[model samples]
Target: MASIYDFEAETLDGRPAPLSAYKGQVVLIVNTASKCGFTRQYEGLEALHRRYRDRGLVVLGFPCNQFGQQEPGDAAEIASFCALTYDVDFPMMRKIDVNGPKAHPLYAYLKKAKKGVLGTEAVKWNFTKFLVDRDGQVVGRFAPTVEPKALEGAIEALL
Candidate 1:
């Protein structure tokens, strides 16, 4: 079976970002959007990153526009919004599709590893989260409505 480290993504600046760089860390992967109602979750995600990063937690935000075109901005605009509004310091990847034929490879792997409610593989909406343990195993799948703070216990356990 392929581990999360087997994947790679592009940074918001279009730089190469290999998942291998985060090997052995507890990772929280989120599909984000600037215009979505849950966009405020960025603050909670950033808080988690700041609190547990030293303890090996890494939160990765992937801007996704698949849902209602909530993230309909270029990389620069997304970066600016995240930084200026939410003070997001964690890594934010380039915008990518979370469903359909053009979906990002990492999302494909994630959905397969951890199916959503009722055994659905498709992500229902933006802000959906995937939790990966230190060993690169996909351990949890959270809905867009699942608040970031709600996962603190799970993250602490993994750490």
Candidate 2:
């Protein structure tokens, strides 16, 4: 079966990043926005990264503007905002559409791997999360409002 490792994404700096590089790690891939109500989730995400990184947790942020254009900013601008406002240290990828023809390849694979509420694979908003196991299999899909702390137990079990 195809795994998440089969996908590749662009870094915020526009370089190719093969998901295979995250092999053997429990990865939490989140679609993010800077101006949305759920933007504050960055704090919790960063906390999750710090708390479990040594245990193979890889939290990846992909700033997307598909939902109400909440992340309308250039690459440099997003980087500055994350660094200055949230002190974000986790890996963040280039801005990309999460729900259209232009959707990032990584997101496409994630949605195909894990369906959400009502058996829908489409992402409804920013902060939607896809958690993958160590073997590159997508495990669970989380709604945008599901707080990062709430994922601790599931993540621990996967680890």
Candidate 3:
């Protein structure tokens, strides 16, 4: 019964980031890519972060390159793109796999806690989102097609 707080990941700057630091906060976790079709969702995600962060919401972007090699950028390149293009101020994690054998452990836990559509655990594409409550429980999963702004209601409920 591991909660998200049990996991740790490296930040875009290559520094250790413990999920425990976000304990008791509602978390929006998304697998992102700089060159994917859904990459624009970063704007909406940043909006969510800005609009609700003070109210206990934290948006975490995990740059993933598993699909079509959309996020084929090094740490610096990814960070620069996110900042310059979308003005993303939310925490961004280092690039990592969202599927397959090399998937990050945090993603593995997330997929297990809340299976995708059709009960499948694999992440189909970039921008897939997982919402965690203040208690660190996975409460919802959103497909890549679900726009980040559409999640406001669900996020407000948890807040």
Against the hidden reference, what TM-scores do the models get? Answer: 0.99, 0.97, 0.99
Better of 1 and 3 by lDDT: 1
lDDT of each residue in 116-145, candidate 3, tens digit only = 889999999999999999999999999999
Candidate 3, residue 40: how far the Cα is off, in Å: 0.7
Please give the TM-score that candidate 1 achieves against the real structure.
0.99
Which of 1 and 2 is the better model by TM-score? 1
* Residue pairs with backbone overlap in model 2: none
RMSD of 3: 0.6
Residue-level lDDT tens digits of model 1 in 1-159: 798999999999999999999998999999999999999999999999999999999999999999999999999999999999999999999999999999999999999999988899999999999999999999999998999999999999999
lDDT against the true structure, per candidate, is: 0.97, 0.92, 0.96
Quantify how close model 1 is to the true structure by its C-alpha RMSD in Å: 0.5
Ranked by lDDT, the better of candidates 1 and 2 is 1
Tens digit of per-residue lDDT, candidate 2, span 40-86: 99999999999999999999999998889899999999999999999
**Candidate 1 error regions (>4 Å):** none
Error of 3 at 149 (Å): 0.7
The total number of steric clashes, by the backbone 3 Å criterion, in model 1 comes to: 0
